[model samples]
Target: MTHMSMSYLSLIVVTMVIGMGASWYVNRQINKYLHVPASMRVTGAQMAEMMLAANGVHGVQVYRGGPQQDHFDPRNNSITLDPDAFGGTSITAIATACHEAGHAIQFAQGYAPMKIRGALVPAVNFASNAWVFLLMFGIFMQLSGLTTLAIVMYAVVVLFQLVTLPVEFDASRRGLAYLKTQGISQAEQGGAYSVLRACALTYVAAALTSILQLLWLLQSRDE
Candidate 1:
């Protein structure tokens, strides 16, 4: 391959390494805090409900499930928490639960970024699933137009990843702010912050990796 190709490949590799490292670090940090119970002794589900009610965000349901499967589904206006986070009264559980609750609050408040991200979801899914196939077909057929179209589709996927960063960060910010103002003590606030911040870093890393991948794809197309 050309020197430029190798350089782009190196950039992708470096970003992947960094992203993986951040993911590992954040998971470790979360596990560390998971064993330390919150001072208020509230389960993750209760904390989520409390935060949503405090924010005047109504009609959102919180459900318990497996670990690391916690997410706020805007479609159903529901929040699903992992077993550990839902049933555990730890700082990690409360912090994550509140973060998901923050998403519900954003939905109720009609947060612009979240709305944009939600709108892009279907397009992003299509782009993610079809881009590689299109690219391969283009290459096999030696069709530059098809290749360009594939690149455009992949770019949409990257845009989705970029837009997700703000939504995630805003949710964490709202969650942390709510925890501080609510019953969370100063010491507990610090712990919650650490957990939320660590979680946010994973999103940041993901965005960076996606951006780098897009850059690499563009460079390769040029070559």
Candidate 2:
């Protein structure tokens, strides 16, 4: 194998380690708070509904989903929470539910970053699926043009990740602030903070991994 290929492999190993480590840490943090009931003893779904109502955000529905699949869907104006997050009164559940509510609030307020991310969803999806195939075909055919095009397409994916960072961070910030301001889950604020912060790190790891992979691809093309 070539030196560049070896280096790329090493980068991949490192990136995978970081990604897995972040995921593990986040899960651990979440689990730690999952059993600790909030002072208000509100279910995740109730908490989400309260947050949305507090923000004067109407028309957004909250529903139950599979484990760890909680997210706010902009297209449908709905927030889907995992079973635990939808029914549990634990600190983790409330915090997570509020975070999704934060997204709903963003949509209501027309947050610019969220809007940008929503706009890029289609292009990002296309680039993510097409880039790898183009890169492999380019490498096999020894076509510099195709490789360069692939790199450009991959950059779109990177941009989407970059935009996502601020959106996620802002959501967490808003969620935490709402919890504290409303005196809900006040006693469990620390645990909620930790859970959200750990979750944010996964996004950081992802963006960094993509950047490293893009660099490796660039080096391969130059060679």
* Per-prediction TM-score to the true structure, in the order listed: 0.94, 0.97
Quality of model 1 by C-alpha lDDT: 0.89
How would you encode candidate 2's per-residue C-alpha lDDT over 51-115 as one tens digit per residue?
Answer: 89988999999999997889999889999999999999998998999899999999999999999
Report the error of model 2 at residue 8, Å.
1.4
Candidate 2 lDDT (Cα, 0 to 1): 0.91
Clashing pairs in 1: none
Tell me each candidate's RMSD, in Å, in order.
Answer: 1.6, 1.1
lDDT of 2 at 48: 95
List per-prediction Cα lDDT, in the order shown: 0.89, 0.91
Worst 10 residues of 1 by lDDT: 1-10
